[model samples]
Target: MESSLSFSLPETLVLPLKTQLISSGSVPRSPSKLPFHHNVSLTVSLTVGTPPQNVSMVIDTGSELSWLHCNKTATYPSAFDPTRSTSYGPIPCSSPTCTNRTQDFTIPASCDSNDFCHATLSYADASSSEGNLASDTFNMGSFDSLDMVFGCMHSVFSSNTDEDSKNTGLMGMNRGSLSFVSQMGFPKFSYCISGTDFSGLLLLGESNFTWMLPLNYTPLIQISTPLPYFDRVAYTVQLEGIKVSDKLLPIPKSVFEPDHTGAGQTMVDSGTQFTFLLGPAYTALRTEFLNQTTGVLRVLEDSNFVFQGAMDLCYRVPITQRVLPRLPTVSLVFRGAEMTVSYERVLYRVPGEERGNDSVHCLSFGNSDLLGVEAYVIGHHHQQNVWMEFDLENSRIGLAQVRCDLAGKRFGVAH
Candidate 1:
């Protein structure tokens, strides 16, 4: 069966990111009391062929579209074929719902008759695709089943890493106003993941620990940077303290004045591998650690960290000193509000494989192209125990420092 509705974009319209951001203002109200934890991760039932092969799908807030891997016979290679399933429909581009889900990147709305409901989005890894703003009924486990329609992305592709990522596609959470997660009556759901555990679930419908808030409650701003694909969140910088081997390192004003807006956005991304700091900012930090580095770990050629030289040794800095200096509080000059993250949170234990006599041993921040884009990017590596909330309705994201209430207690006590 052929899909009856096909929404395509115009060939010549150009819209700026600022204009697109304004469009996001019209999105539906966000689910209330968000930030719920899923004791168990939820899974999606993917219908691949005419017979309906159910593949377990992951519910991700990081993506807005839902897709799965299949053979060549699969519709569009990257898209979900509506004809093969009983839960899809053809939504016209003129429809308000369609406009909400689609965006115009390389083209403009005026160039085509499709009303800008067709879009082409690209990811940081340079993967790109084209699709229309449409909806499809999705099954959320046996408990929460409904016609949850979302962007039916076509010709989609992404960079695969490791073995597990190949079969997975993204379910975007950043569809401006067209976000399907908000359309469902159950506005809030928990996306709980286990450390070192690839298997996680999407807690759809609702949970006891999760709470929903009004859309008008919080403030949110879209992050702007040199790199467009990294859909990042910007936060105010607040440095609580800076210490080198138990000694306080004085922070210079030239390095952190708010007006030097060139620092870019402090990125909150789940896709990136590590957090990067600017060259100037990194220099100031290194000055303090000069004495604290206990020993050196030889840097190898073609190192991922990209140190200045091929053979630079990374010195060890004691953890206790950075967290608690003589000063009552270590101030971090930031773009907006001054905030201090936990010392334990920043100090990472060197992976055993990369430790002593191996190659690099330093846990210090390094230079990354991402630094040029925005002030900082808080990658997935740093997202631990904290519950992050991206409320479209409220327009602001909330970060809560939380502990797993059921961590040690789950699975009948960890013998």
Candidate 2:
């Protein structure tokens, strides 16, 4: 557990946070230096005009307005151009969403102030966007009976070579925001994602996991500085079990190391989309894996497993390291209780074409390269059917496992 000072959520902090962390720059903070309450999940991606084009993005419920990358000099191109995205056309002071609109948000009526309710988005490469809010359509599989609106930042700023320019725009799915699901007041919704092969769901509002698995929630913190995406939740990371070559290793509280000396600040973040392990904890685990399965170990590059924004410095070992054969069950000890995870859950799967031995593929896990930005990122892939309760006032996070059938209905375990 780590500790971090709480900051009040303000409206003006959005620009700086986007400029520094979300866009291009990486914010350097130890994984243990964050408030347990700062977590949110959103659906984001980009698309072209009329017949929408396919663009990747990070969905954010924390934001109300939705926008995609655009361009100014673009002619009759095949698809959306990050180099020429939506540009913010100057709206007169009489505009509804900006001035005459309700003052519920931080956007002020005065256009002179930077906080004026104007839609201007910027990227780290110096590209910027200026646009307005517009209703956008959304459809996930057959669950398409919903309608919502998003922002069209007429002036989108992004470089052709910059990685951020790759996506169209973000979808907002925050608890208090206006999304298709939120507007329709859908009592239940789920976001499903698969890597190169497998898939999982991000269930919102309710799930079967709540009753099946025991869960615990951490505390919440207030954001003093205002940012466009300010909604957050608390998380408690517990180690259920650790094993190496059929040997169990006990992790003590002393293994925990936080940079700021803050207390009880460990958090699980979906926005980050990476899993980060502390230095001491990682070192111990790595040493154990190597020491036990020194035989039949293949020294392959960790880069083999790719799940978008996953970290690096990961490797794979054979199921022979453990006693189980079907799927190597790796047990984790979280909050004093032991939780066993099969290889399919955490390990990267290598297709038969890529397999070198008797196993289907290697285990997929988090990369270690995402050190300063996030310590432990429980990405969208591994957290499927897991109902996560983000309680701001209570300062805790609760997880409930769920089972779904081919019909996507609630059921027992997968097997």
Score every model by TM-score: 0.56, 0.50
TM-score of 1: 0.56
Candidate 2: where are CA atoms >4 Å away?
1-65, 70-149, 154-168, 174-205, 208-274, 301-340, 349-363, 367-371, 385-415
Choose the strongest candidate by lDDT: 2
Residue-wise C-alpha lDDT for candidate 2, range 1-415, written one tens digit per residue: 1112132211110000111113111233221111011112233322333333454344543333445544433421222443342332334445564554323333433443434345554421244556545443443322331234445555554543333443455544444334433454434333333332222333433433443445544333434343343223223354434664366766666554232333223344454333445545555665665554445345456455443333332345454554323434454445533334444565544433233443333334443443333233344444544545543224344554444222122321121
lDDT, candidate 1, 56-156, per-residue tens: 34334444444443223333233345567765554566765555433422232121255535555555445555555444554322222344545444455
lDDT of 1 at 270: 46
lDDT of 2 at 167: 46
Worst 10 residues of 1 by lDDT: 13-22
lDDT at 287, model 1:
54
Worst 10 residues of 2 by lDDT: 11-20
CA RMSD of all predictions: 11.9, 12.6
Q: Relative to the true structure, how large is the alpha-carbon lDDT of every model?
A: 0.38, 0.39
Candidate 2 at 302: error in angstroms? 9.8
